[model samples]
Target: MRVLFTTWSSPSHLYPLVPMAWACRAAGHEVRFAGMPSAVPGIVGAGLTATAVGSDEELTGMSASGKLAAWHKQEQWPADWPEHPDRLSPAQVELLAALGRKQCVIAERMVDDLVAVVERWRPDLIVSDVSTFAGAVAGAVAGIPVVAQLWGSPGVLRYENRALGEEPLPEYAALFARFGLDAPVDPAALLDPCPPSMNLGSALPRLPMRFVPYNSAGEVPSWADDPAVRPRVCVTWGVTAAKVLGAAGLEPLRRIVTAVAGLGAEPVVAVTAAQRELLPALPDGTRVVESMPLQLLLPHCDAIVHQGGAGTALTAAAYGVPQLVVPQRPAPMLLADRLAATGAGRTLPHHVVAGDEHADKLVADALDALLTDPAHRDAAVRLAEENAAQPSPAELVPALAALAAR
Candidate 1:
């Protein structure tokens, strides 16, 4: 079987698909990944063949802040924006409009690439990241089945769809039609990649909205398994917050380091290349490493402190580590709440630690609680066991394979 996969080209979006891609190939199926050129390295790193589907120039050139500014000036805006036009602060309005436009641009530019890949490779099935609507259209045009994948549940799951409310699925189909691609039937089948029981008791449609386990394809690094190492604490804000903290929010990192220091735990900080230079001097025991592989690091850690990206939070839960999430975004915060409900973690809001104001005290208290309290640790371990018990890649590969066969 030939399978075509597409995502938004960001690491967070593409990384989850790596496991399935590898599993498909290991089972003797042909798999090809199509997305941003920047994503090729990650796809290849996962040992899958890749067909580049979009240019990085289109994705990286635009800034979220810039687009928001333009939308603020427009007289009329896309009706589906989450906020009321008159009620929003100028900044908020611009931000919403910018995000909508960015999605539209991404969908438009990716269409040509998706169509080109289908014309050349003619894969039997397409698995697209939630943001890559054009890939779904391209798959439809090529007369193949397409499955949608998501990192987190979109908000529409909680709200009923109507003329006024957000309708991401319908919006995607409309965007594809604009690009002259075939409309995907049962577009609901394409929505996936969210974990089970995280959808707040809403019943999912049977066919495509299946709850597949979250996979970051994180591996246990060899150095992490050593018997004599000190108790570990993994600290990260993911790529988005890493940029924000490094550029606009540097003090947050500083506060976190100060709070975690002298706590008798080793701090494993994940920093990107550019952010590496901005590190404040640390105490003797703190370790500043550039992007230590998380799955490798999680087993070694006693607890995790992060900005609550679903990928990291789920990975932490899967490993049964007590999590302390400071939400940098809303969707991930909702997932954190679900994890909290399962006794896997706690959600520490931004306002709780804002402005480096009381962050040191807040983090110190949370970490102290996570480390010393047995209840938190036990809960984390229990959730980890539950998550671990979910169907593995061996099971998922066959299910998707069946989809391709159909």
Candidate 2:
């Protein structure tokens, strides 16, 4: 069977899908990943065929920082910006809508790329990231099945609002209508990478499928296996967060470093080029390294400090590592709170973070509480157990194979 895995341009969005795509190929199925051409290297690195969809330069030029700055200047927020009455005012909503409308111009081009791929490859099934609706529309047009991979918060889905404790936005239905699909898609399967233990709520309408855990890209560092060293702690905001938060947001990460330094465990900070630019000279005993896949690092780490991105949070859960989620964004914050509520981690506000805040007094206190606290550690471990029970890509094959056999 041939599978076409479609996704958006972002690394956070594309990385989790890598293992599954690899698994599909390992099973002898011809698997191809379609997205912005910038994603080609990652797809090829994963050993999957790359089907370029849009321009790499064009996608790279779309700046989250620029969009946020414009929105901030206009006192605007995107309508899709999570429901934070304080952050997203009526004026902000207008700004967000205007931005969203402009963004659709890029999306339309993405759709055009999807049409071209379908015209040529004509695969049997399209496992797509919902943000890239072109693949879904193409699947519908070609009469192939498309399974949506919801990488972000549940708010993107109509019913997910209620589950995620958000008020339903009737307007989103119209957004979906524009894509020529029912407002609330009855997913063939809702492969939620977020662990159910996180309590994100099950707003998705019931379908033939269920939520699954994320497979993060990093591997466990070699030192993790040593019984001698105090457990290692992995400190990282998601790739996008470390980049977007600039110096101010990253200041908290530095504080996290100061707080954890003298404590028992070794601290490892994983950052990308964007973060390195703002990274203040690091304190001694704290190691800074380039990006190592999340799956690779999580096992060695005793816990995590991050920006509360869904993928990273779930990745930590899958490893049974308690998390400290400092969400600069409300949507990711709300999701972080849910995980904290489940006892998988604790949530910290980004505003209070300061140099003195690193007083190690407060940061160590929190890390100690999370690590020693049976409730938090237990919850994360339980979720890890659940993830292990889940079938890997090989397990999902029978179902897709059945679809193809038809």
The candidate that wins on TM-score is 1
lDDT of each: 0.64, 0.64
| Clashes per candidate, residues 3 or more apart or on different chains | 1, 12
Residues 221-262 of candidate 1 have per-residue lDDT tens digits of 566777736667878767765443345444465566667775
Worst 10 residues of 1 by lDDT: 155-164
Quote model 2's TM-score.
0.80
Q: Which runs of model 1 end up more than 4 angstroms from their true locations? A: 58-63, 66-98, 152-174, 179-194, 201-223, 228-230
lDDT assessment of candidate 1: 0.64
lDDT of 2 by residue, 226-331 (tens): 6736757788866654444457657678778766776767788988767778787767877776667777777778889887777787678778899887766545
Which residue pairs collide in model 1, if any?
A: 148-190
Q: Candidates' TM-scores?
A: 0.82, 0.80
Residue 240 error, candidate 1, Å: 1.4
